[model samples]
Each structure stands twice: as structure tokens, then as C-alpha cells.
Target: MRKYLIFIFIVLAVAGCKKKNKAVTSTIPGKPALTTPAQNSVCISGTIISATESQVLFTWNPAVNTDSYDLVLKNLLTYTSTTINTIDTKINATLLRNTPYEWYISAKQNSSSTTTQSDGWKFYNSGAGIVSYPPFPADIMYPAFGQVITPSNGKIELYWAGNSVGNNIASYTVCLGTTSNPPAIKNGLTESQLKDVAVTANTTYYWRIITFDADGNYTDSGLFQFKIQ
Candidate 1:
């Protein structure tokens, strides 16, 4: 009798543990894929909100296990960013006309704290009397902002990717120094990467990129800083 009672209690405890574990499930949201306002494309007017402002429809494919999403829109010229959260997969946003912008989406789930970020895209907002649009700011690859590195070889490489609507990028200019406003160090660079940049240990460096298009329109990448260890 005693052995049978012990066996029954063990079976009940095992079943109870299984049932409790089965009731809790967690899912991480998948990264949302952008659908409209295609990358490096121009977004025509959707609904004109004002003479200088227009409404743009941003759309993306829904993600698995996603409960909500956050859309980030950045003005390349002013380097200002706005984030909007929604449960739906699309949002209409008011933006300045004749502006360059980049956007990305983030997927979130209530069951998990993890948020997935989608790929980023940039577009030009069309406007009246606009003949040419400035190039979007270059995307930095190495020596990111507030990054620290050890310069064993006393040199570092600078890398970035430039984008434009017309694919008419003329040249790239690199600026580097210690001050907040660095002067142009290299110009007329046809490639995206500059190697063998001299650096010293235990010093901070500031850098930025300037992109010029064939139409003479230019865009400045905001400043980034790095420290050498």
C-alpha cells in the first residue's frame, strides 16, 4: 500500500509539471519586410497635407508572432528621426516635401521582450518645382559612433556606402579630425572604403562623409566618433 501511494504521488507531480510547462509559451517576432516606397526610389505625393508637407503611405509585410510594430522615419538633411508605434502593418505619415528620408520597421511581441528590426530603405519625397534631389546620407560601415578600438598598427580603415535616387554619385569626400567640425581630409574618392588611415592609441577621432551627385546636389553624413585604445 505504501509503495503504491508513493508511485501515485510521483505520477501526479510529473503530470502537473508537464501541464504547467505546456501552458506557457513564448514567441519572438519576426523581422517585418518593407513593401512600398521601394528602396532608393522616389515617393510621389500621396495626399497633400500642406504646400510644404505631404502625406506618405509606408507599408510593410506583417511578421509572425508580432503584436505591434514601430516605424522609424528619419530626415536625412536634418538628421532628425521620428518613431511611431502601431499594431497594423501600414501607416500614413506626414513628411516635408522635397526631402530625403530613410525608414525601418521594428517588430515586437507581448510574449517576449525581443524586438526584430527590418532592413532599412531610403527615398526622396517628391515636391513641386524640384528638379533634382540631394543624395541620401552615406551609411557608415566601420568606426561607428562612440566606438572604441585598439590601433595596434597605428592605422584604421574608414568605410561607408552611399546612395542616391539617380545612381549619379560623382564622388565621395571624407572628413576627419579631433574637433566637432572636422575638415575634409580626402576628396574625389571614387570608392566606398579608404584604407590605412593613420590613427593613434588612446585618442578620440571624429569623422563624416560628404556625397556629391552628378547634378551637383550634395548630402552630408552626420558626424560619428570613435576612440582608440
Candidate 2:
């Protein structure tokens, strides 16, 4: 009878240990949401241009069960990205002038390896000179910066906002490839958007737009990337 009781006690202890392990493994943190530099925002003001230049302040909402957050900022023109880790909800970062950038946040917990990411957003810096002057470069609209599309979605549709300056935009061109500085895939495109472009699953593609003005002036929209799901 004593041996049997000891065996039963051992079984109960093992079951309780399993339950505790399961609970710890299921603890997942929620994704942090970005607040500033709203999606597709243009001409964001309040940039300080001094010897000690001011940094761009990024803000986001707190996430549940998150111990820290990772902020990622990317320069579309330079193809450079910066990642910073913080325990708070905001960070001040030095960025490029007259450039468009995309940013996103990830929620992280020290105990768990899993992380959640927020939707990406884009904004243009208010540089010293008139960045949006005539013959402006086309601003990409679809397949947003850092977007993922599943293979089952079929052909991808590429879209962009045409130059707003004078009637200078005579035509637009698109360059797409598996690597950076993708060569011009389609040139002399008159429309602002393209459709039925083939893409492979589990692959990343970089794209850019080249704008030509009636006066023979041309501008290039820096690089943007997206992944196939």
C-alpha cells in the first residue's frame, strides 16, 4: 500500500509539471502598432536643420505582454536600414534629408523567441530644399514597403502616384528583379500602375520607378522591396 501511494504521488507531480511547461510555452506577446508618420504620408514637417541636427522621433503604441520593442527604419533611396531596440515606446533617429522612408515595429519578450510585427508605414522627410519640385519621382503605392503576398494571390499589381509637379511627367518606367538595382523590366510605361506581373513564391523582389519629363529631365524613385509568401 505504501509503494502504491508513492507511485500515485509521482504521477500527479509529473502531470503538474507538464501543465506548467505548457503555460509558459503558450505565452506570446502582441505586436506593437506604429502611430506617427502615418501610412503613405507626404511632406512631414518639424525637421530641425542645425549644426546639431534634430532626429526623427518615432512613436508607437504599447503592446500586451511585450518586454521590449524593435524599431526598423529604412531609407528608400539609399537602401539602408536601421534597427534599434528599446524598452519604451519611442525613439529618436537621425535620418537622411529629402528622402522617403518606411518604418515598422516589432514586439518582443525576453522569455520567448517569437515576435509580432506591425504593418509598415511610409513618410517623406521635410528636407532643406523643395524635395517635391517639378519632375518629381513617382511614389510607389502598391505592394507597399515590406509587404508579403501569397503565391495563391496570382499576378501582382504594381502601382504608384505620378509626379504632382508641372505637366512634366511624360512617361514612367518600372524596374523589377530578384536583386537590388533591378534593371528596367518595363520601360516607357505611360500609366501610373502595372498589372499581371509574374512572381515566384518564397522570393523577394526589389523594384523602382524612373520618371521622364517632357523637358528631357528624369528622376528615379529609390528602391522598394516585397516578399512572396
Candidate 3:
């Protein structure tokens, strides 16, 4: 009888151990969700901004949950990308002068997640704008040459010589005015074609051509001043 009692007690203890282990194994917690990073976000908008030979200065709106931003530089042709720098706020990177550089920003929410990429922007050391301005509509050519020919209709027939390099001429922005302050802007044009544009007789118009390369850096032409007769 004593042996049987002892055996029964051991069986009960083993069953209790099994029950405790099962409870602990079934109560495991779920993993936490990953933090979301803001996508492809970058801004250079600010007041009193300028770029020197070696650096650029600009400000942007802060992002939510972002600990910092990653600045990336990419070669337009080869599709090679490199992380040039990381910063908690705006940046002024020392860059090669007069070279075309493509850059963009990505937000780092934390160690876990990052935002989607913001749109890329381009700028030259020569103080050119990032966005491309296509050829002027109603103009004689997409990229108007320095000298123009006046047709019999008393209209100015302008012609644009495309870029000498392999970079395609995306478009041009034709400004018809004396100065840039209040110049009339015409957008979109076919490449390398002559366009007949009407103008007032004996009036001078200042115009320029803005061309976008493959990666979208705009190389602009100096202002071409002409007169209508």
C-alpha cells in the first residue's frame, strides 16, 4: 500500500509539470510591427539661398519620425549610386565645380524602417535650376540660335542647335521679354525643328534655352536678344 501511494504521488507531480510547461509554451507574445519610414522625401526650398563653387545652402521641412536623412549621388549614365553623406538636418556638401551631379534624399525613421524615396533634384555649380524647361512653343526652333532669320511674314523664325554632346535635348523655355523679371514663358517643343513665331515689329525680345539631359539636369543657354521687324 505504501509503494502504491508513492507511485501515485509521482504520477501526479509529472502531470502537473507537463501542464505548467504547456501553459508557458502557448503564451508566447507576438512580434511588434516594423516602423514606417517616409518615402523619397527631400526639399531645398528656402529664402535667400545660394550655391558657391564648393557648397550649397538650403532648408527644408522636417519629417515625422525621421531621425535623419541620407543623401545619395548617382551617375546619370552608368546608374551607379553612392551614399555621399548623412545628416540630421539640411546639408552643404563640398562638390566638384561645374560638373553635373544627380542627388536625392531618403528619410530614416529609425533603425527599423525608412520612408520611400523622394524625387531627385539637380543643380549645377553655375547656379542653374534643377527642373528642366522644355523648348518654347510658337518659336522658330526648340533651341534658338544666337542669330535668327526673319521670314517674309514679318515673323521671327528661330532655330535651336541641339546639344553637342550625346545628352538629349529634352525641351526649352522661351522667354519673350526685355528681362527675366516679367518675361513671358512658353513651354514644350519638338526637338531640332524650326518654329515660326509672331512678334511686334522693331521690338526686342530676350530669350534663353533650357535643355534637360538624360538624368534631368538642365543646361541653360545664355540669353539671346533679338529684334522683330
Candidate 4:
């Protein structure tokens, strides 16, 4: 026969080219499964609804398949930190006053290799109750900034500030007066207490800081004139 039918047609064309090269090397091409895992990392939850004296409105909660998101704003009294706001899906670190801020957030995974750090936040900038930071002054925190320390000897160290205008520090009020519009006795004042009171020195104490919200509905940061030195 013609050389065994051309050697059986070249052995069935070399076994059909070795079964099409073993079906194209057993079909390979896989990679896609990493939905934030370094043990399910990345989390941040902080809120400061609204504030003024420039700006500082915050909100957070978004990260499920993240491919981008990183914001950092730290200046808790000038500890300095800013410049890192990459967002392809979530962002908010706009500030210009209303001090006291500390933030943190991170989550990026385009098939992650590594990059995850979230869970850090601190906030306090309660401005816009219409012009803040000027009513906690009966020498409020003027220990070395105004020279007026009195309310002496029972160990008086009272400082007030919370009519909330621009650097919102929303808590403070230590009263015990002699007329200057001071007579709030529900047992004699105690709301959002920040402790330090045992007055009776050079006595001439009259205080006020009723910026309220426990449903006692307040907003009175007038009257602060100390004397306990």
C-alpha cells in the first residue's frame, strides 16, 4: 500500500496535535477573590453632624469592596497631620477652624496585596450656634492668658467656656453667686460635669454656662466673673 497509507496519515496527524496540546494546558486563568481580608479589616465610625466658624462637618461608614478611600486629619492641638485624601468612593476632611480634630481611615483593594488601617477618630468643633468661643470668659482658661485668678482657698480653680461660637468646647459651669443672674438650684447645678470645685477664697463667685441639651433645652453662656485667689 502507498507506504502504509503514508504511515497511517502521519499517525493520525500526531494524535491530533497531542489532543490540541492537552486542551490548551488544562484551561488556566484565575485570580479574583479578596474582599478586604487581613481578618476582615478596615473600619471607621465618626460623626459631628454640623459645625461652623469656617467648616467641619463629618460622617463615616463605607467599605465593602473598596478600591479606594483614605483620609487623615489630625491636629488635636497642633499635633500636625494632613495631606492624604485619595477617594474613589468616599471622602470628607474639610476643615478650617472649629478646632479639636483627629481622624483616620483606610481601605484599598484592587485585588489587594496590602493596605488597611481604620479605627481611629476624635471630634469637638461645635460652632455655629451663632458665633462661639467668647462666653466662657470669666477668665475661663485664662490661667496664664489674662491674669484673673480668684475664688480662693477652698481651692478654687474654675474656668468657663461653652456658649459655642467657633471652637466648640461644649461643657462647663460652676456656680455659687452673689447676684449676677446666678440662681439655678436643682441641688445647685451639675450638667455635663467636668469636676474641680471646692470654693471659698476671696469669694465673689458668679458663674453661667447653660448651653443645654438633655431636654433641659439651654443656651446661656453669659456671666462669669471669678474671685477666689
Report the number of the highest-lDDT candidate. Answer: 1
Q: For every model shown, what is its TM-score relative to the native structure?
A: 0.91, 0.61, 0.35, 0.21
Query: Where in model 3 is the C-alpha error above 4 Å?
Result: 1-96, 100-151, 164-166, 180-185
Instruction: Tell me the tens digit of each residue's lDDT in model 4 across 75-170.
Output: 544557885655443444545444545566666666555666566545444344423232222224433332456544455444443332233443
**Candidate 3 vs candidate 4, TM-score winner:** 3
What is the Cα-based lDDT of residue 145 in candidate 4? 31
Give residue 200's error in model 1 in angstroms.
1.7
Candidate 2 residue lDDT tens string, 118-165: 998777665665534335557789888899987545678899986534
By lDDT, rank the candidates, best first. Answer: 1, 2, 3, 4
**lDDT for predicted candidate 2 compared with the true structure:** 0.79
Task: Score candidate 4 by TM-score against the native.
Answer: 0.21
Off by over 4 Å in 1: 1-24
Q: Which runs of model 4 end up more than 4 angstroms from their true locations?
A: 1-68, 72-93, 99-102, 112-117, 123-229
Across 1-229, the per-residue lDDT of candidate 3 in tens digits comes to 9999999999999999999997765222122221211112222222223453445442345555556667676533334577744544566565443344456666665544536455555433323453433211122343243444354686555566544233455665555665554263566664544356666776667776555555554545555676554
54 Cα displacement, candidate 3 (Å): 12
Model 3 clash tally? 16
Off by over 4 Å in 2: 1-21, 43-53, 129-171, 176-185, 188-208, 211-229
lDDT (CA) for every model shown? 0.92, 0.79, 0.49, 0.47
Ranking by TM-score: 1, 2, 3, 4
Tens-place lDDT per residue, model 1, 115-151, is 9999999999989888788888999988888999876
